[model samples]
Target: VEVRPNPGGKGFVTALGGKWGWSGSGRAFVPQLVMYAGPADYHNKPKKIDADIETYLVGHGFNGFHTIVCCRWFDINEERSTRIKGPAPNPDPRTFEALELLIGKVHSAGGMVHIWAWGDESRRQTPVRLGGKNGLADLRLQRYIAARLGPIPGWTMGYGYDLDEWVARKDLDIWHRHMHAQLGWPHLLGGRSVGPNRYRRGAKFPQIYEGLDYSGYEQHQPTYEAYVAALAARPKRPSFSEDRFRVRKPSPYPKKDYTEELTRRGLWHSTMAGGVANIWGKYVRRGQKTTFQPYDHPEWIKTNALFFKGRFVKDMIRDNQITDGVCLRRPTGEHFVFYKEGAESIRMDLSKMPGSRRAVAVDALKPYREIDLGELRPENQTWKAPQKSDWAVAVGEFRK
Candidate 1:
């Protein structure tokens, strides 16, 4: 994951290089930037032209290595729709030049690319024009992107299609296979806007994950377990939680209570739910302000750093060894229970995971230390919280 110096200095620009990731194997990767192409406003401005590639890079670059970058698709399609109606139309020199430069800069920053081709969403007014809303637009755009950036090794392509429409797409499977087989890139085919209203409208989006390789959403259910359960139903597919940037208050200065703890818990929950493959967490700033500086908060960076730094934590997430959510049961005859809370300790149920040995209270802030829970059986065990605040405990068999 990408991180900058504390109190990310005034102005959008920051030092190009600084601490970037936790020094450990299997660390979680974070996006260096989420770029929005097309006009800034919700509508297409005929004269606005292409993305402000220069400004975007200047503001978000660091050490010529952006671990991950996502470009939100907006108007270029409609603007060039007349000439490029065919799926394989010649690449627009203007768009190609701009993307080539932007992508080059991203590559210099050591980051991969993700193109968010918006599909049937409230945020974007322009629908992909290739197939004329026949879902063929998705194919055409994918092909175009593949032809242009396909040769690049580190790149992914996905769409921000709405939940209902995404579910209704009959070509979902075919699209997934084409992207994975032809392009040789992971197809993160899922939608966002899983707000409470969508659920209230009698629409169930999670049920659609069985068809997706990776699922993503900003708002979905109240707790992590619910999202995990839906994701767990399809153990193979992972889930991405684009939690709105957890800010404490509207302030230019960094605040300590930016919901870092809650966000950390959600990350941990996602880690446990999907393992390394299934988990991708993004903390985005909400409100009218456009600039993103979550690193200004102390815990946002530290919590993630610590979680990823721990070799054990990395292995746990990658190996899919962690089983602690709804619709997903703990591994039988062996289990590790990780929880974050304020109390001194919490009870763990080892009913299913038999042959368990002990529980070790781990410090989330500084995760190196461990508190042995003595010898424990496959039943309820009182696991003590290692730290006074923002503590997490790991219950399983590992050095007493």
Candidate 2:
């Protein structure tokens, strides 16, 4: 069904507000973190997923989080009569019930949810075959799924169409539009996993596609320095990281090593780089402990619950101006200049900044004790990191 624009000639709009807009905070751009949970978590065993969310990722400091709900293709594709039947196109009632429950929990927790489905298979870096043989049948399936699940508030849907490179296909865009017109929620497209290649692929898309609202790239455990640089140079659009967590060969880094500080650091690391961090919940495999349980890791709980107070460093620096270079500033009067880890100090030129600004050094590890660099005037400021260990200094009009 080709969806025509509304009477005003504008494209489809959702109850969530404009198709593309900043999050509630007004400053944060499409702030979210995606995570995948198995069927059990959403089924009768809802307590575990709920507990992990309430206890670990939400409240206190972690606000405005979005987790993508991923499921096995077979789970939603199975038929009734409690039998393995052919072409069960409609969403199973049991699965819909579970999804309804899960969506409610996500809303109550002050977070957004997303349904993840793979696009029709094509020869690519990672081929995903979701919509089977008949294209029209697949469209009907998607339409039925959308009509049933569309009204769920504060959620988005994404089709894994591109993986690790640019495919330049129009079918993906068509699918996105169909979903948007049917579901009334903006859909996301694009994925180029790995460092600069991800952003490179995203840049080539033709400027205007009616329904495309956001794009994402997956970075498998990229260093902070590299992540920040790539995001700064990428296209100026709302971006999300499909995968940002560290993973080893056999299993993901265990809880102790994948500490809370590390998790929070990774999140900010991506956000500061102008991208959203998808917190991979399925971290390690330890005999029935296959998925991410933030409570299990002491550091994950401790750091996430309290560290990185509301826009601490971000409030000081300019948005989208964060670069590895010595200086960062915005016309709004925010300023920042910091040294990477292992750097003693950097000679910064402050002539461009206004006079009488507050300068403070931030230790990424111990955020509580922010050392003040005293009243800084516009000049060649030679600032040193007090107490070392990866320090950053922000000189700007201080906000309370």
- Please name the candidate that would achieve the greatest lDDT relative to the true structure: 2
Off by over 4 Å in 1: 1-113, 119-125, 128-131, 134-140, 161-167, 171-181, 184-188, 191-210, 217-221, 242-258, 275-289, 310-337, 346-362, 365-383, 394-400
Kindly report which residue stretches of model 2 are placed more than 4 angstroms away from their true locations once superposed. Answer: 1-25, 29-34, 44-46, 59-84, 119-137, 161-168, 187-211, 223-234, 247-268, 286-289, 295-328, 335-339, 346-348, 367-369, 372-374, 397-400
- Model 2, position 157, has a per-residue lDDT of 53
Worst 10 residues of 1 by lDDT: 11-20
Query: Which pairs, if any, clash in model 1?
Result: 1-30, 16-63, 64-108, 64-109, 65-109, 65-110, 66-109, 66-111, 238-278, 245-284
Q: Give the TM-score of candidate 2.
A: 0.67
Best by TM-score: 2
Query: Candidate 1 lDDT, tens digit per residue, 262-323?
Result: 55555455444543211122234467444433234334334433433332332233222332
Deviation of model 1 at 266, angstroms: 1.9
For model 2, the run of ten residues with the poorest summed lDDT: 10-19
